[model samples]
Target: MTVTAPEMANGIFGGVFNLNYSGDKNRLIWHRHWLVCISCGAYAGVGCFLFAPRGLMYGFVASLFTSCCSIWADYVHIEDPQHLAHLVDRWAAFHFFFVLVCECAYVLHMPIWYLTMTLCLALALFSLSRSSRSRQSWVLLHSAWHVLPMGLLLLPGLIS
Candidate 1:
C-alpha cells in the first residue's frame, strides 16, 4: 500500500501530521496561527524586561503553558470546527486565570502583571486573526481589537 504524496499529506497520520507537527508546510492555517501566538508570547516576555524582571519570567512561563496547550491540542487532532471552538474557549479561560495571577503579582509591584497583559493582548490578536478568513479588512479589524488592551493597561498607569 504505497500512499501518494497528496494522500499521505492529507491523511491523519502522515504528511498532514508532519506539516502540522514540524510546521514545515502550511497545509493548515492553524499551524501558522499557533506559530504566531508562540512568537507573540515570546516577544511579550522579552518586552516585559523594560518593566520588571519578574514580569519577564512570568511572561515566559505563561507563554510556555500556552505553547504546551496548543501542542497538546494539535496532537489530539482537535481541528474540527466544533472541537476547535471548544479548545479555543478552554484556552482563553485558562489564560484569563493566569492573567489574574499575573495581575496580583503586578499590583504588588512584582512586574509580572505587565508581561501577562502583553501576552493576553497578543493571544487575543492571534485568536481573532485565526478565527476567520484571511481577508484584509477582517485582519485589520481583528488586529485593531487585539491592541485595545493597551488602553486598559495605560489607564491604570495614568491613574497611579
Candidate 2:
C-alpha cells in the first residue's frame, strides 16, 4: 500500500506535473530548506560521532535529512505541473532508500540518543515549515521548534 506519485498528486488536488504559480514558489522555498536541513544534519552527525560517540543521534540526524529531501522532492513534483507525478515517484523512491540507510545506521550504533532527539526536533521544524501558510508563521514555528528542544536538552545539564 505504498502511495504512488499519481495517487499523491490526485489526493492533493493537483495535476501530475502542473503546479500553479504559488506551488512553484513554495517548492522553491522547500528546496532551500532541504539544502539547509541536509547540511545541518551532516554537521550534527559528524559532531555526534566526534564528540558524543552516539549512534542514535547520528541516525536521527540522518533521518531528518532524508525526510527533508523527500519533502523537497514532493514539492518539486507539485510545482512542476507538466510532470508532477514523476517527481513524486522519484521522491518516494529516494525516501525509501534513505530511510533504509538511517535504519541500518541506527542498528549499527553509529548515532547516539542526543542525536536522535535532535533529529526528531528537526523533523518537527520541517513539518511546521511545510504546514504554515504564512512566511512569518513558518519562521516563528521553526525558531520555536529549534529552540525548545535545545533548551530542554541543556536544562538537565544546567540544573546539575
Candidate 3:
C-alpha cells in the first residue's frame, strides 16, 4: 500500500471540494474554505520571504494560526466549525493585516491602505453573513480575503 503524493494530498484535502459531505452542507464548506485560507497564508509567507524578508516572522505566525485552525477541522469531524474557526480566523487575520498596516505606516497619507482595509472588511463581513446562504459565494469571497492582502502587500515590493 504505497501512499503516493496524490493519494496523500487527496486523503488530507479530499473533504475540501466535496460539498455534499454526507448531505451536511456547512461542515465541508468551512473545512474547504480554511484549506484555501491556509494556502493563502503560506503563499503570503513565501512572498514575504522573497520580498520583505523582515516580515517573514509575521507571515509565519499568521499562516501557523490558520494552519492550526484548519488542522483542527481535519482532526475532528464536527457539525459546526463557525465557533472556533471564527475566533482563529479573526486572530490570524488581525495579525497579518496589522503587520501589513504597520509596514506601510510610513505611507499613512496614501489611500491604498485605507481602501484595502475597507475592501477586506467588507468582503469578510459579506462572506461570513452569506456563508450559510451560498457555499460558492462564501468560498469565493473568503478566498479573496486571503489573496487580496497578499497582492497588495507584495505589490509595492515587486514594482520597486
Candidate 4:
C-alpha cells in the first residue's frame, strides 16, 4: 500500500500508526507509549536468533535496539530530537554496520547488488521520514520501521 494513501492518510501506513505529541513535555518523559514497530522487531529478531542462528542474529538484535532507542527517544522526549538528531544518525549508521557484519559472517560474502539495494532503501526511507510532515507520516515511518530489521532477520536463511 502507498504509505501516503489518502484513505489511511493520518499515520505512517495510514491512520493506524498515527502519533500525537504530548502537550506537556513532562507528560512524555516516563510514560512512553509502546509503539509497534521496534517492539515487534525486537521480539522477532530475538526469536530468529534463538530458533535459527544461521544468520547475523546479533547484528539484527542490536539494529533493533538502536531503532528502539532512537524512536523512544524521539517520541518520549525528555530531550529534543532536533538537537540530538546526530545520535539517531549514529544509531542508523550502527544499524547498517551490524547488518553488514551479519552478511559477512554468515553469508561468506555479500554481493554488490545486495549492498547497493540496502543503501538505496535506507536513503529512500530516510528521505521519506524527513520530508514527511504529518503526524500520520511520522506514525507511518515509525510503524514501517520494521521493514529493514525483518529483512535483516530473513536475509540469511534466504541466501544460505
Candidate 3 residue pairs that clash: none
RMSD of each: 12.4, 8.9, 13.5, 10.1
lDDT of 3 by residue, 30-49 (tens): 44445454545543453345
Cα lDDT for residue 7, model 1? 65
Per-residue lDDT, model 2, residue 78, is: 37
* Candidate 2: tens digits of C-alpha lDDT, residues 58-105: 445544554444344443443453354535544543453355345434
Worst 10 residues of 1 by lDDT: 15-24
What lDDT would candidate 4 get against the real structure?
Answer: 0.48
- lDDT accuracy of residue 70 in candidate 2: 39
Candidate 1, pairs of clashing residues: 55-112
> Which 10-residue window in model 4 sums to the lowest lDDT?
14-23
Tally clashing residue pairs in candidate 2: 21
Q: For model 2, what is the C-alpha lDDT against the true structure?
A: 0.44
Q: Which ranges in model 1 have alpha carbons more than 4 Å from their true place?
A: 1-34, 40-52, 55-62, 74-78, 82-89, 92-131, 135-160
Off by over 4 Å in 4: 1-52, 55-61, 82-89, 92-108, 152-160
